[model samples]
Target: MGRTSDAKEKILSAAQSLIELRGYSALGVAEICKAAGVPKGSFYYFFESKEALALAVIDEHWAGQKQDWTGILNSDAQPLDRLRQLFEVTEAGQRAGQQSCGTVSGCLFGNLTLEMSNQTEAIRTRLQEIFDAQVEMVDSVITEALARDEVAVTDTREAARSVVAQLEGQVLFAKLYNNTHRLSPLWANCLALLGARVPQEALAGS
Candidate 1:
C-alpha cells in the first residue's frame, strides 16, 4: 500500500496492542505514534480522533478473526466438537497473549467494553455490535448441534449467550489472577451447557 495507508495500519496496530496491554484511556496518541514509528502529527491526519482510531482498531481485529472463526465453527465437523475446538483455540490465544504482554490481557472486545463503555457512547455502540456478532456466531453453532441431534434441544440462543458470558468471565478472572490456565471451569461449564459429557478432569477442576 501507499505510505499513507501503511502508516494508518501501523497506527492501528500499535494502538490495538497498547490498548489491549494497558487500556484505552491509559494510552495516548503519542504513545501509539511512538510504538508505530509514525509521527504524532500523522495520527490526526489518519484518524479524526482517538475514538475513531479505536473504532477502526476494533474493526481491523474483527476482520482478521472472521476467517478463523468461520473455518473452525462452520466446518463439517460435529457442532459440539467445533465448539470445543473454539475453546482450544482460545486457550492457545490466551497463552500467546500472556507471552506477549507478560499477563493475560483477555478478549479485546471484553476489555474494551469494560474500559470504554461507560465513557464513550460511540465506542460502546461499536463494541455492542461486535459482541452481538460474536454471540450470533455461537448461537448458530448451537442451533446446528440441535438440528443434528448432537445435543438436546434448548434455547440455543440463550445457551450461546451463557457460554459466551461465562467464557468472558473466565477470561477476566484468568487475567485478574495473572494465570492463563484458569480456563478449566469454562470448559466444564461449556460442555455441560451443550449437554456434552463433561470430561472428568474438567469436572474435578483439573
Candidate 2:
C-alpha cells in the first residue's frame, strides 16, 4: 500500500516538472511513466487519462500557491503594503525558479491557460475557475484599501481583475524574455491600476 501511494506521487511530481518545463501537449503517458520511474501500468492505475493527470497536477500546484498567496495577502500589513508584498514575493519566486532551473517557469496556471486552455473544455473551465478565485482574493484586498481611502478606484472588483491580469501578463513576459527583470514593473503597474493614494516614499519601503 505504501509503495502504491509512492508510485502515484512519483507520477504527479514528474508530470508537474515535465509540464512546467515542456508543457502538456508534447508529453505522452509512456514518457511520463519513464520520468516517474514507474511502470506504465502505474500511470493508468493512478490516472484514468493524461488529461486527468494534468488536472491533478494543476490542483496540486494551486494548493501550494493558494496557501502562499493567502498568507501574504491576508497578513496584518496595511492593505497597499500587502499588495506590494504580493508582487515582491512573486518577483522573488520567479527569480528563485530561474536560478534553480536556468529559466523562469512563470505561473503554472497562466502557462497552461495559454498552451492548453483553448484545446480542452475541462482545462478551460478549470483555468477560468482558478483565475476567478484569484481575482476574488485581490478584490478583497482592494475593498479593504478602498475602505481605508488608500486607493481611488470606484470599482474594486474590476480593479482587482486588472491587477491579477497585470500580474499574469508580467509573468508571461518574464518567461518570454527569459529575464526576471520583466516582473519588476508589476508593483508599479498594480499601484497605477488601483490609483493608490499612498505616498511613493511610504510604498517604497515595502
Give each model a TM-score. Answer: 0.91, 0.94
Worst 10 residues of 2 by lDDT: 197-206
Give model 1's TM-score versus the native structure. 0.91
**Residue range 50-157, candidate 1, lDDT tens digits:** 999999999998887777788889998988888878888888899998997798988899999988899999989988887788789989998887887766647987
Q: Estimate every model's Cα lDDT from 0 to 1.
A: 0.84, 0.90
Alpha-carbon RMSD to native, per candidate: 2.2, 2.4
**TM-score, cand. 2 vs. native:** 0.94
Distance from true location, Cα of 184 in model 2, Å:
1.0
Per-residue lDDT tens digits for candidate 2, residues 108-202, read 99999999998999999998999998999999999999999879999988999999998999899999999999988778778878888756743
